[model samples]
Target: MPEVARVVPLPHEVDPQPQRAEVTALLEGGLIRVRLPDGREWDAAWLQAGGSTSIELAAHDWVIVLPPAGGHPAVVMGRIGPSARPPRRHACASRRPRC
Candidate 1:
């Protein structure tokens, strides 16, 4: 496996604001995936509707991201599912906590 970071979402989780644009950017950037518990899979950019938790990032470890689009950072009400791989340097490096 080439090792990629995955961002998983939980069901019924509410996002303070639906960041469809940001998610599309990430998907177009080729850095995200949607992992379903039922074994279905999809690209991050494919996420359209709001309130979907069954998202996952495969290949490398992922860090929760809250983009500063509006004055308030986008919120994700889900967990980054457990990973069997080590955290990738590019995953958390060059990132700072939002003030």
Candidate 2:
């Protein structure tokens, strides 16, 4: 018999609330330069999940800029997406023998 894929539920999407900025340049160490709508430019770091995590930001890409709070540099949350990708499937969700 052919193996059937199990459907995993996706997490609810959270609304992104931040100022919009246009990427002007990609810098070393996951940093990026962005220009806000008001014409001010700032260096911001792209957020990642781990020490080795890196996300490439391109010039003219629209990103959400989060302001500094609690003594942290302004963060580039992520590039604005038409639609968010669903979360990855859980390990047990794909195990057929246990089901």
Candidate 3:
């Protein structure tokens, strides 16, 4: 029998309630520096997808930042529109089996 490939869907829209931030700098160790709307800056980690999906972010990229849980750093949730460059693709993990 031939192997079947499963297709996972990407997030159709960004988080409705995520805090807006601008990528100030790109850092090492899968982290990026971001400046919040209030002018505060912090190094935040990218939220990992459940499977193998990864989102690529660059300097000056506008992204939605989610508040940190516990003592963890903030997570970059998704990107915003009106970007001059082509947006990167990302996938979200699903609990349902592939149909």
Candidate 4:
């Protein structure tokens, strides 16, 4: 009996997966640049909104991104609900951490 060879990927190859990314800049058309969790930045296309109603995407917004695959470009699925800003420490009379 002949044994079947198992398919495997080399160490340098990465499996495509959904990633949370931060919008770094808005480009012409529906294109934008996003920063991944690992601090790597990539160009992605905004695909959530359509002609009739438009989604207002901006820099610093958190979004769900689908990595490029099979000749397809990297795409943004949508924002992570209401855009959340990074926690910031502020000087306030109330002495709150994120005032």
Best lDDT among the predictions, by candidate number: 4
Error of 3 at 62 (Å): 0.5
Error of 4 at 15 (Å): 3.6
Error of 3 at 35 (Å): 0.3
User: What does candidate 2's lDDT look like per residue over 18-82, in tens digits?
Assistant: 79999998887656888999998878866664432445567999998875443345678788756
Return whichever of 2 and 3 wins on TM-score: 3
Which regions of candidate 2 deviate over 4 angstroms? Answer: 1-17, 50-55, 69-72, 84-99
TM-score: model 4 vs. ground truth: 0.58
Q: Write the per-residue lDDT of candidate 4 for residues 10-88, one digit (tens) a residue.
A: 2335466789999999987657799998998888876644441356778998988877655555788888775557687
- C-alpha RMSD for every candidate: 16.0, 14.4, 14.2, 14.5
- Tens digit per residue, CA lDDT, model 3, 1-99: 943544433344534356899998888786778998899887787765553254567788898887554445677877676635756555553455679
Q: How do the residues 1-99 of candidate 1 rate in per-residue lDDT, one tens digit apiece? A: 744634545334444342222122244454454333344333432322354434653444333343333233243333345644766688668899899
Q: Best-fitting candidate, measured by TM-score?
A: 4
- Overall lDDT per candidate, in order of appearance: 0.40, 0.72, 0.70, 0.74
What's model 3's lDDT at 78? 72
For each candidate, what TM-score against the reference?
A: 0.21, 0.55, 0.56, 0.58
lDDT of 4 at 99: 50
Worst 10 residues of 1 by lDDT: 16-25
What TM-score does candidate 2 get on C-alpha atoms?
A: 0.55
